[model samples]
Target: MSLFNIFNVSASGMSAQSVRLNTTASNLANANSVASSAGETYRARQPVFAAEMAKANQGQVGTGVQIKGIVESDKPMLKEYMPDHPMADKEGFIYKPNVNVMEEMANMISASRSYQMNVQVADAAKSMLQQTLRIGKS
Candidate 1:
């Protein structure tokens, strides 16, 4: 792999993590939303990522990461009995989003760490390039 490919790899990683963070935030934001009907309930969303590889002389080499798509969780929404709630259904139950606050918090932390690692990789690559340029000055 070429040294320049490091930047591309790190950039893709950062982009993927950004999408993950956004989706996690959205899930957290809707965690408390109540719906009168199951169909109207919000489902937790997650981003799917795939590895991009390139054909090289030796073999397939990793290029970077790509976001395949965002998928909604199939887990059942929370059903709570709140007779006095304005959004309660005919059965005195309200449907809450399937989002788990703790899980979303964990995802947020993981995504943040991945983003930071990618930034470090890019910085290291930049420093290496700068050092390579200075090698000729001596």
Candidate 2:
């Protein structure tokens, strides 16, 4: 692939990772939110990604990543019995989001690292391009 293509690929990766990080943060923030009904509770969302392929001289090459869609987790919500809680239902049961704090933290870390890696890749490509330009000056 060309040097320009590298920038495009890395940029797409960074964008996707940013979306992932945002979703993870949202999930973490709502983890403790309580609702009287399951329908009113927040469900964890996950971003779906797909590889963008290009038909090149060589068979096929991945150009970048694309976000296909965001889907809500199918995991069951947490049902806690908290009679004193104001949001509790008539049965003294409160529904909490299915978001797992530890899991979301891990995902946040992973997404951050992935974004950093993409930045590094773009920086390396830029450095290489700059060095190539210097060759003409010399």
> What C-alpha lDDT values do all the predictions have?
0.92, 0.93
| lDDT for 87 (candidate 2) | 97
Index of the highest-lDDT prediction: 2
Q: Which runs in model 1 stand beyond 4 Å of their true positions? A: 54-60
Cα RMSDs, all models? 1.8, 1.8
**lDDT of candidate model 2 versus the reference:** 0.93
**Candidate 2 residue-wise lDDT, 1-138, digit = tens:** 689889988999999999999999999999989999899999999999988744443554647888999999999999999999999999999999999999999999999999999999999999999999999999
Model 1 Cα lDDT, one tens digit per residue, 3-105 = 7988888999999999999999999999999999989999999999987744343374647897999999999989999999999999999999999999999
lDDT of model number 1? 0.92
What lDDT does candidate 1 reach at residue 67? Answer: 93
Which regions of candidate 2 are displaced past 4 Å? 54-62
